[model samples]
Target: MPVDLETLYPKLVNLLLDPVFVVDESGNIVFVSDACESLLGYTASEMIGTLIFDYLHPDDRERTRAEANRVMTGHPHTNFENRYLHKDGHAVHILWSARWSEDDKLRIGLARNVTSLRRANQTRDALYRISEAAHGADSLRGICDGVRQVIAELFPRNDLHLAFYDPVRTVLTVPDWSVDRANDWVEGSMQPGTALAEVISLGQTLLASRDPSQPGLGVITESGLKSPGPLNWLGVPLISNDSVLGALVIESQSEHIRYCAADQELLQFVATQVAIVVERKRAEDHLRFLAHHDPLTGLTNRSLFYDRLETALKSAGRHNSLVALLYLDLNDFKQINDTLGHEAGDQLLIETARRLEQCTRETDTVARMGGDEFTVLLTDISDLAAVDAAVGKIREVMAVPMMQEGQIVLISFSVGVALYPQDGRTARHLLGSADSKMYEHKRRRQAG
Candidate 1:
């Protein structure tokens, strides 16, 4: 064996699972073993004449070249890792061991494919990061942002979209997306039968490319209206409890990058975690909304109104300012409920709340106390005229006829105005004084 080492070199290379290569000083591959076909998806005959740097991942080429330069100059490199492009266009992670052959003027290297091992490590790390985000993010938006970051770490992405489906409304809406591609997909409602809708309907992950044969799977690019030519797209449904809540989508227009089955699996895993967190956040938000807002009109309820009023009083006291409290009651509301039915009465209340909201400024607060009674708090008032004008606007707006069930119903409001520091010093006092004044106005109207 020692007598004929050079004669047995080819036989030894054939027995190794890892690919062996010999390259010249110019980085041209001079010799490549048959095992390259399994490691790089290219046969030795196809890779023998090609430049070694040509097969490397573009982003990793400079560093790889620098390391190779050091290895060629009388040094050995062991277990140096770099990414190369497979013939199928996916990344092939490789761990290389190389030494310079001074007599032959070539670099002899052995390459072991580590793509699966690297992907496994990345998957574990990504899941850990996603778990942290799921538990630590303060809001739904924060969770989505963390998801986007984790995805970007694993792959190159041009656009990432997080859409939420409203089951009750049968519509899909994008809540988070990259800024450059923000307008790529319209943020409003997406109708049924669209690509995203079909994904939700099927509750399956979709991997789409710009292939004409694949209809209804077009890539969404700059201004969702244009054609996405030669791009790759992946969408995974965010499913919770066997229900599809929405989708997570990623798009890439680069020719160098394409998504594969492994990428799809990873995205599906992340989507599952996202779905759980999103569902919990939505439920919490719904409960919080119910606690702070009136169920009937979607306006601030009594509890929230008192908290705001207290805060406003404190601010007013600090600035030596005045606040206006308008207490309003619909006259003969019970008669309308009795004659027209509760449905008509509810419609009237909802419309009245809308008009009251329109009659106030952005700084003002409108709240429904219960049973046909509403209150408006106008803060930081410099003069009484502003409060008077607001009252007049409300009266004029309410004078218009409202349509309820194909019938025109005329409504009137008795409004009582209370000024801060003059009417009362506290929220309770101000509220009681305004209620008493509202009843006095109602009695006067009845007498008239």
Candidate 2:
């Protein structure tokens, strides 16, 4: 092989990916690939006379020498991994294979661009951290974004998407997406939904592959959506508890080649994390629903009420507005409970909470302070008229008779209204004032 001409004898030193190195028997570097600039940031001239061993990453220098010596001895190694020091002082993990360059005085090293491989290895170890973070996510959007970010870090700037199946299998909605969920490849990204259901259910081809010939988002048929455009799609089945939860589809435009197997694997790992997060979020929502709610009444419990009340009061202070507190108790509740039993009473409380909730604007709050006692906080109360209006609405709904177990119970509520700053500032004081007014109103009703 002539050292001066590369094009004349292209077959003698031609490689598409791995950089080939030509060295003398004494291991002095001569010819290198055009990829040297990308891999090592050095031109061929800069590395021509440098000892091959001089450029190896200090950690991999010994192994690199051993591999070269072994290859020189006529034993060819197909694939091996070692680090090389780039001109910028970064360690490059190269997956190299070698053979003698015909003259026996020269050796050629071929390698895949495995700098991304090293990053992937490091990211795989770091997945546990993302997995742990996924545990605390509560909303679907947050969970999707978390999973996407973890994945995007591994395959930087790649399109990542996660879709979930609703209770019905028909709608494949984008529950929420993580970082850079969709890139420039698609016409528009609206967190694709049932729009891609046909492709998702029909696309049968899937596996661990390194094929870059097809784009990831190709499955979605553009004619099906409002706008027809080129899209490449790749999906991984999301299985949890032996059930198919949904499919996570990753995609990009035609400008980008389809995703590779390494990308698919990392996406699958992220999908698994997404499944965990989805389940966790469901459980948390269930727990939250149980805690801040009465099992029977479906009204805010005392805990949530107190927190809201405090916040409302703070808001009222800023607005220089009065907040009206109404403490209501049903007269003869015990009589109904004792004669009709607890289930009947529960129905009555449920109806009562519903009526009370409906009676006021959404900004106002009505909470079950455990049992027949209910508290309502009405912020920005304009005057006594506003208070009367709210109380009147409550009375109307309460008058809607409760038909429980074929028995009609006409329930009357005694509500005491107290104003903030006018009654007392503290929650305890306001509650006491409302309580006192309620009993006084009760007495008036009985006497009348």
Highest lDDT: give the candidate number: 1
lDDT of 1 by residue, 337-429 (tens): 898899999989999999988888889999999999999999989899988888989899899998887878899989888889899989999
Candidate 2 regions with alpha-carbon error over 4 angstroms: 1-109, 113-129, 132-140, 154-159, 164-231, 237-247, 259-263, 281-292, 314-319, 331-341, 401-403, 406-411, 446-448
Model 2 Cα lDDT, one tens digit per residue, 1-448:
4565645455554444556777877889887876677887888789989897877766567877887888888888888887666674445668877887656678877756687767677566547756766665556666666766665655444566555655453444664233565631223232333333433454332422122443333333434453233223457767667555666766543322334454456667766666666776777888898899877787888899888888877888889888999999998899999989998888888888888877788898888987799999998888889888888888887887778778888999788888888898877788889989999999999899
Residue 436 local lDDT, model 2: 97
Candidate 1: Cα lDDT at 279: 88
Q: How does model 1 score by TM-score? A: 0.87
User: What is each predicted model's overall lDDT from 0 to 1?
Assistant: 0.83, 0.70
lDDT of residue 275 for candidate 2: 68
